[model samples]
Target chain A: MVWKIQGVEGENYLESIKNFLNQLLKSKNVDAVLVPKRFPDGNNTAQVLITDPGKLDDIDPLAPVQMVNSAQIVKELTKDPVKEKIASVLRPCEVRATIELIKLKQILDARLYIIGYDCPGVYNVKDYIEKLEKSNGIGKEGFTLSYVNSFLSGKQDTIRESCQLCTHFTGNSADINIAWVGSNSSDVFIEVNSEKGQSLIEGLAGEKIGDLIERNQKINKILDERKKRQENEIDDFLGFMQRCIRCYNCREVCPLCYCKECLLKPEKMGYSSDRYLRRATKKGQIKMPVDTVLYHLTKINHMAFSCVSCGLCEQACPMDIPLGRIYNVFGRKAQALFDYEPGRSLDDELPVATFKEDELKEIEDVKE
Target chain B: MGKNSVDFEPKIIAFLCNWCAYAGADLAGTSRTQYPSNIRIIKLMCTGALDPTYVIKVLLEGADGVLIGGCHPGDCHYINGNYKARRRVAILKSSLETAGLESERVWLRWISASEGVYFAETVKEMVEHIKKLGPNPLKMEWAI
Candidate 1:
């Protein structure tokens, strides 16, 4: 059953969500709440753990700005079992990455209540800060609700490229999904997807809403447009990779690149001075800080299946390389070979971690 | 197959599993089976141990081609190393191809210990293919 939280008088979309989170905290159900709050820098936003109901005032979990994927944050929170229950409010992509992390055994035993929302795509941090300054006089919530309404109406185009093509913006894997797309940013809807989500909304002030036909149609429209625009148009990989200085910032920002002992590290790659000189001599010449392409290829081989296509890698690249689009193209193709969608479910096996005895025979000994 | 790139000799890195492919190469050597002197063989305990990083390293470091030989399906000495290798190679090749590189430069072939003639023929076929493709494009370029 879908429940609708009617907006209180004079409350915008952001205020409605804040009030909802405040009630959930006072429900005596969850122990602590993790949410994205504006940093002291007055520009960036990051996840903040709140234990008191009073601390929910300055929070804007529905803000259209994501500097980092919260999957890494969730993994850190649940690394050791929580003392009690903790509720994490996250975006759709963060929820996807969280599910993948749980499957990869990165998250330990803990009571994690996942609160996901229909993400109205995010801006690169720079753009978000600039937008904040442009609307500086208005309060944060006032600016955010207008932003959400605009995004829901399909007027903005400055969202990150990955967000434009994201088919999972509806929080498909979360236990509880907060939807605002078809509600016109006025009536916030809470969708309980699991048993834990039911408890979070227990005895709350809301009416049981019926079929979400309008909401479903709007979501389907977005999905259709993104699907049509999902083709890989990269023509020359060599030319595209010309500006890489081999800094590996893409790997550092990727949520799925969770290996503690990465083989791509310079020490692990074993590129001694002698080996570099010999390789340059052997090839008549070689890239000085070599293996930029190799690093990408190996990373793709290792974590492409787990990639959520969140575009944090592209945001992190100092060279402004479009690493997000490249991974999205290749990662989806790799997953499609086995008919696997990473982070879709906890039951589905990772393609790289498991294999069938009699399957994928065509790949071996074949020229193709 | 005498079609040639004249003086251009392609460098091939052959990661041959010891139980099957390496033994097959040894058998080819003892049986007077002649193959092109293009491949530099590195023996591994199993194809499962063959990380894609090595293949990528040699390719980026300017090896013309890579040939990973292992046991056929249901014939793996470690029970299923070849199967895993097959999947890994499939992913690696797709990643390479999507990035606009020639996935054909890397080949995954099954060569059993008893298939000594097959091993020599596979090497001959690979050498010919590489010769036709000429030197690896990454060979002359210094900025990878």
Candidate 2:
């Protein structure tokens, strides 16, 4: 229940991860190592993939921006039946989303070694790179640990809207919890939240440990403020989303989105000429790219029950739509109605997939 | 038969495939055989080319019932068009029924180039049934 830490610079975090994997590789303890890789385009961008331990040293884990949710990548990789055990380094969001994917049968495994990290915040890759490009102090000189620490101290707006409202900033269920925030120092807090996490902690023979109680409390406080900010941001975000051209980028990037055929495609479901004419007559102007509300509703009704709130959908939007908040709204409702949290645990049943006679009766009764 | 009992006459929309069923209908005409006048044939290339949505749309838009006629089993001019059509109807029927629509509103029948007698009888049987049952409730609702 207690979170723990060891002080190291952000630059050292990646190097330490490489070192940890290198040690595991030497021992031949795991089959593959999953890490973040830098994009070739000179942007402060990174993506997640399962790579061999030999490639661990080149991983850009400390890269200041996020483009895609690592959880989705992990879900794709883990979906196939595999015999080899792989160790995946996940941010808190990734771990949470991955849990939901596991429940949906989108990702399958007993062979995954999840190493969860405490996140300070991450910027949208494009926005972050643009800001970094304009700033004089930080350029291609490479972001050092001190620079990140300074940025954190100033409370600059580096985080995405999804990240600001992220309540689950600390991963609750991972084989190993690599803590960063909530403590007085920048040291990594390593605590085992589960039996496997404890085993991983015990496996680290020479690493120093520190108290994580104050750190967890600080994390909780930040989460509280972030939740309130998230609601306001969602209102502002939806105003921007009304401009969406109906591109499916948000759906494509979403990790927990496992539908084989999306209901939004015009072929499956689109406004007929009759519906179009009706809308035109009623509203005086026909909404182009029609059924926008229905598209979101159908998707939310179908999948919100298992939404992991990974926020990759927002990142993938070309329109810069705050799809994360829209998803979170429905997802929060589905979770509350069923008293089921997606990705919180592997054994939990997915709400949409599982049918119960008495479930959602209150809502059903209201309808009746 | 009881005095109050009306004989069941099935309402049928025979969608004749241009190659087979339509040819059969034409043959029925040329042969000078007396057949039911109730059938209204809509010519199509192959039974497999049917879209279930189109079928549902028409059914909901006032078609009392539908009868999709295709080439018998392996006799389809477009290889497996009939086979595929069969599968689509099977899925559509169950889905529509689940959505509270009557599955009987849609019907699939495979009649080859030689099944004129069968086609005529099928149409007669359908008209008699529909006349007794009245118009489809769904069609009435959509109209309103």
| Superposed Cα deviation of residue A266, candidate 1 (Å) | 1.2
* TM-score of candidate 1 relative to the true fold: 0.93
Per-residue error for A115 in candidate 1, Å, reads: 1.7
What are the per-residue Cα lDDT tens digits for candidate 1 across A1-368? 57885443226666667877887888778878899987664566679999999988778887788878899888888988757788899888898888888889997635998889888888887888889889887767667767877877786578888988789997757778877778754657888887778888887777888868888999898888889878765676667677778798888878888999999999998889899888889767776677788888888899888889999998998888888788899889999888988778778988877788777666664452
The deviation in Å at residue B118 for candidate 1 is 2.2
Candidate 2 chain B, which ten residues in sequence have the lowest lDDT sum?
B1-10
Off by over 4 Å in 2: A1-11, A39-42, A48-54, A135-158, A183-186, A198-203, A206-211, A232-242, A270-285, A355-361, A364-368, B1-144
**What TM-score would chain B receive for each of the candidates shown?**
0.95, 0.83
Largest TM-score belongs to which candidate?
A: 1
True contacts kept of 1: 0.75
Q: Candidate 2 lDDT, tens digit per residue, A69-116? A: 777678777777798777787877888877777766677757887877
* TM-score of chain A, predicted model 2, versus the true chain A, to 2 decimals: 0.82
lDDT of 2 by residue, B1-144 (tens): 222225433345667898888887887778776776655678999977775656665554456777778887668897777766665455455444433455665666666678777767656665655565566664434111
Q: List residue ranges in candidate 1 displaced over 4 A.
A: A5-10, A40-42, A202-208, A366-368, B1-6
